[model samples]
Every structure is written in C-alpha cells, then in structure tokens.
Target: MTELTGTSTGQPPTVDLGPYADALTHNPHPVYARLLEKSPIHRATQPDGTETWLILGHPEAKEALSNPSALSSDPANATPQWRARYLGDPNARELPQGKSMINADSPDHARLRKPVQRAFTPRRINALRGTVEEHADQLLQGLPSDAAFDVIDDFVAPLTLGMICTILAIPDLDRDRVRGWADRIGFPTSAEDVTAARHELIPYTDQLIADQRIHPGQGLLSELIEATDDGQMTPTELRATIFLLLNAGHETVISLLASTVFCLLSHPDQFAALRDSPTLADQAIDEALRFQPPAISAPPRFAREDCTIGSTTIPGDGSLVTVVLSSANRDPREFTHPHSFDITRPPGELLSFSHGVHFCLGWSLARLEAGIALPALLNRFPDLAPAAELSALKWRSGPIVRRLEHVPCKSGARSSAAPPHNN
Candidate 1:
C-alpha cells in the first residue's frame, strides 16, 4: 500500500493511488478519510500511471461538480497528454464512443438532456411505483426456498434490469445482451475492451431506435426517437442518449440494492429498526447511498482554466479533477458521526447522485426502486442473513462503481412467519 509521507498538518503528500485502488474498491471510507484528513485535495498517480487531482472535501467536491466555468466534462478539452495517457489516442475520435449527456458540456448537454428530462420527472417516476412493486414481489417469489442464493444475480440485478428495461421499452430478448454490454462498459479491462463494447452496443441501440421509429411505444426510447424526428437530436445522439439511460438506469440501482441489502444484513440492529418502522425505508436507502454509494466518484472533470479548489491550485493544462463523492458524503464537517451508518441520520443533501446540471437523470427512479424493493425483500424473508462472511464476499474491481460480485444469503424460509411490519 502507498503510504502518505506527510502528517495531516504538513504539506500534502504526492501519493500513488494506484496501490490503493483495490482497497478503494473493497472499502474506501478509511482510505478516503485518511486522505481527507491529510489534504482535501491531493495530486495522485492512478493505477494506469496517469496523474490527476482528487478532491476529497465536501465543499470542494460540491464546488467542482457544480462549477461549469472552471471545469469541462468533455474529454476533448483535456490536455493532449492527459487524454492520451488516460483515454488512449486522444486525437483519434468519433465523438469518443460513449459521449452522452453525462460527458457533454453545456449547450450540447442542455440540448441532449432537455428531450428526455420529461420522462424522469417526479410525476412520471411515481407512476411506475406499481410496476416496481410488482417486479420486486415477483423476484422475491422466485427465490429458491431450500438453497442459498446470490442476492445480486437472483434478486438485485434482475429486478433493476427489469425495471430499466420496462422504462426504456427494451425487449425481453435483448436484456441479457444489454446486461453483458453494460457490464463490460462499466468494468472494462482495457480501453480496447470499452471501445469494442461501445461498438457492439451503439449498433444495437441504433436498431432499437429504428424499430421505435416504425412502431412507437410508451417507453423513453420511443419518446427520444420522436425527438429525433423533430430534429431535436440526431441518430448518433439518440443512440448515445439511450445507451446512457439504459446503463445508468440499471447499473447504479443494482449497486444501490446490493449494497443496501449488504449493509442491512451486516448490521442486524439497523435491519430490525427498518423492519419495525417500514416508513424508514426511504431514509434507510439514503443512508445506504451515503455509506456505500454506487459510483465512488464522478467522472473526471477537466479543468477549463487555472482554478483553485480550497488551498490547492489546479492548472489549466488539461488537468483531470475527480470529485470523490464517497469521500464527500462522509465528511465529518458535514455529517455527524460520519463513519457510522444511521438510517435516521436526518435527511440532508448527499453527493452520491452528484450535483449541478450533470446530476443523475434517473435519481428519482433509483430512489423509488430502493424504497419499494428493499422493504419488500426484508419483509418477505424476515430472517434473511448473509450466507457468506462479509470479509469473504468478492467486490467488483473498478474505479467508477463499487459493487459485490454476488451477495450469497440464506433465504430464511423457516422464519418467514411474519415480518414486524409488512407495509
């Protein structure tokens, strides 16, 4: 492990974060806390040997995320060296494959996001409460009564994927393929792998959009296609938009569901609290999000010009600055008892879903799914507990998202007598 050479009161150490990348994936709070205490902003070398700035303070992270003038989301704006080292062949471009709303800076971002924003409004998401409930119930009903099952594969993944597919009108037959592509995109081993996955997925989305053109449906994909017809967006933009929605919609929820369940199961007292007061489900989900956010950090934000965050000066020479959402959510200055997980931690703003114009478009939908699915799962299997030791569980190895390979657990069929509250 790379150790910080300086004390918290001294100059910030130039640490190589590459060595601690695995630790970040497994459990980042301790590492983040240590880094934050030493320096809220530190210059670190990534595993890939690329240098970047990591913002670990709550105030700085929020400012970096919401500051449009100082930072640009577009990779093309990055310094050639920074882009080539991190993204490979900085000049070779075809809009960089997965260039969607999340990556596009203003004007383009505003244009791309405006079309689909209506589909994710509070009113629209709330309408799907019934659908989310039915899917959660059905997934719980299918769990094997006599065998231990992986909560991620048998429950969370399917439930989240189903909800996203339903919202996007993805045909059932395409779901497995979509999931495979999404997995590769989220956790690619190499740049070539990501490019190849994007290559495969873009054409698939193109066909989906083409199909929607001929026969429109009530899903967001069909709605975006209609926008394309009105000249609001091009075919490429439409495909990219749909790709973003599908991956973002499902993957984040999968992490949220799995982590929320893992947290509850690991902390039985908290689980009992939730079961006793089902109304705490939403609060519990928020706490889980703060405790173990799906996306550990926002995508790297390139400095548009020389900008200062806190006491650190970030040069404008294409510096890639990443706001560590996981760190910010646990900042002691912001949240009381930052390390402890309290479902009733008092509702407050969290950086898990990000902030500013680039905030997650699917935030409402994700919250709704967690609120319904979590309570339902716990209530159905009142004695649900981890079959595997928490230390033994395999966690996904990626910088962007934190998730378990599988959450193996005993279904607790014998204790399904009745939950404390099954509302």
Candidate 2:
C-alpha cells in the first residue's frame, strides 16, 4: 500500500478542488500530476459535501470503470449521505431527470442502451455528414470577414444545436429552449440549479415524446418511441432517453469543437501545422480531447462490492467513487510529454470519452463535426487567430464539465491581438 498523505488533524488525506480555482480554470495538469504521484486513489469532499474516492491513475481508472459487478452506477448503491448531499434532497433516489444509460447498472443499462445504439449506427451518423457540413458552411459565411467573434456562441453551439435537433427532430422554435436548459444544467454552479434546470427540461422532453407518438417523424426519437411500443423500453425510460440525448447530445460536441480551436490557437506552431496539412484535423481533434477533455470526470459510481483499486480497498457497502478522466488522461505513465498539446502524436488509451460500457455514444458524431467544422473554418478564413490572450479568455466554473464560456477570435485581416471582449 502506498503511504497515504496525512493532515495535522490525523484524518485521511483529502484534496479539496475548490481552493484551486485558478489552476483548474487556466490549467489543471500540474495539480493533477502532483496528486497522481502520491497515490492513484484519494479521498475528497465535493463542494456539495459529498465524500468520494477519486481514481487518478490511468490503469486504476480503467480497472474501476471496467468492473461493473463491483462498481455500480445506480444511486441506490450510494451511501445515504452521499445521495442526500449530491441530489440536495434527502428523499431523492435518482437524479432530477431520472435514470438513463449513463447512470444505470447491468441489465438496465444494457436494455436502455440497445435501442439508442441501434438508432445511432454508422450509417445514420454518416448520413448526417451533409447536414453537418451545411451547418458549418452557413455559420462560417455569417462570420465578419475581418473582425472578432465568439466561435462558441456564433458557430460551434449553433452547429451542434442544429445537428442534435435535427437528429431528434426537435422543432426550430423549441431549439433555443433546449439549448438554454442544456447551458444551465451543463455548467451548474449548485446542485439546486441543476435540479431546477432538469425539472424544467423533463416536462419539455415528455411533451416531445408525446408529440412523436401522434405524428411520427423521421428522427431518432420516432424510432425510440417505436422501441417503447414494442416493449423494448418503458415510458419512463423513453423520457429519460430523450432527456439525455437533448442535454448531452449537443453539449459534448460544443466542448469538442470550441476546445480544439482554442488549443490549436494557443499552440501556434501546431495551428500552422494543421493548416499546412488538412488531413491532420482528425489527429488534432483527438489530441484536443486528450489534452482538455470536455468532461472533468465520469458520473460517480458506487461500490457494489468490496473493490480494490491499486492498494486501496473501497468498501462494498455503497461508497461513492469518481474516475477523474482529466487526471487519468494526463498520467505521465500513459503518454509521452502528457502535458504538451501535440496533434501528431499517435492515439492510444484515452479516458476522455470514458471506458467500459458507459463510453460516450456520441463520440463519433463529435469527431465528425470537428472534422468538418475545423477544416471548413480554417480553409475559409485561412488566418483565423485569437483576438485575446489565451489567459484573458474565461472558462465556465463547474465541477463535471469544463467548457469555455466563449472563444473570441479574429478572422482575415483582424488577426491582431486585442483585449478580451466582455461577452
């Protein structure tokens, strides 16, 4: 067993991330590196007061994530205090939006995932290539030829929003409402805010499902509705599925597109390299996902049985455990020059989309968007650059997701550096 770091009070070693705001916002690799060196596992208390065991090492995280028999995603397996603190309600058994594949264990997860999986087949996703390109082109055309604009709000978000909406067949008018709910839930400052945003989103999702039943559309939702009718899924599961798609569907892609642009711009040499060789766009996207993942950690998994990660044994009786993807992806043992943003590096083990059965379903879609959006923007503008110093740009302060609030950039002749816009 590794010698645990100790505190003066003689309690177990604990890491509170709240104190490291600046490091987390600007760059969190150094802090994570120090923690990984000490031990792969550490005890920590979340801002909401939920105690959790964090898996930091690359191998340790893989072991924990792959062992479904030992680690469960159901909150029912979580400690009472963890459940109470995490949900902000002592009586709450599930998240405000209810159970979905991302938080389900075993048979339930498999059943829920099957139908959605069938709907997102390669053919289905690949067919959307035309739509993705069209959206990117339309957004790029609107950019001022020689001025600063937010890559996030003006381009990435709308393109992602359009893609997800088109896939789910969400109406044009309702698209903004869905985006608004996703924004609030994705970057929530408190458990209460998440709860409120989810509560608002649920009814909206339910209504969409209801509408689909009456007038079947050509989108994935209509297919999922059929699955429900065939006894493949329950009504509650249908609602939960749509809710998950709407929320996670676009948000992850937004993070991917925006973060890739920001990372390349920050490393001018790499940006130039990518421009010189357009085929490297795919490699660049993968590197961006590794260097600055959209998500900070996977949903907390509870110990269903006594499980040993590295030298630490997590109790069998419902203990909260979180796999820190950001840390694991940067573990020095896992990659060469783990902290540097090198787009040409060969892809290997990456936890950015997580591992095991819960790996992100929309990963391919996100890559496709980036493949189209990045090259399209660059090819058109050919001289797009950051308008503000990378440090001057801001990231939303949140626990689960690390997304830029906005990415200000200059196009054409406006590539000169300037102060950050207040937006």
> What are the clashing pairs of model 1?
none
**Model 2 poorest ten-residue lDDT run:** 414-423
lDDT of 1 by residue, 1-423 (tens): 467545475545667877777676677788879888877899887767777789999999998887877888888788788666556676743244556788788888998999889998999999999999999999999997678988889988999999888988888998899999999888888878887887888788888877877888878887888888899888788878888877777889989988898777766678888878888888889999998899989977888798888888787877888899999998988999988878988876799999999898888889999888888888777778777666667778554787888988886532222222100
Q: How far is candidate 2 from the true structure (C-alpha RMSD, Å)?
A: 3.2
TM-scores, each model vs. reference: 0.93, 0.93
For residue 228, model 2's alpha carbon misses the true position, in angstroms, by 0.8
Clashes of each: 0, 0
Residue-wise lDDT of candidate 2 within 1-423, one digit each (tens)? 223446786445877765665666666667677888888888875545567888999999999999988999888788777778767766677887778898899899999999999767899889999999998999999999767899999999999999989999899998889998988888786778878888899899999888888999877999899899999888888898889899888888888888888888777778889888989989999998998899888878999799888888888878889898989988888998888889999787999999999988888888888889989989887888787777677787465678888888887543434322221
Enumerate residue pairs that collide in model 2: none
Candidate 2 shows a clash count of: 0
TM-score attained by model 2: 0.93
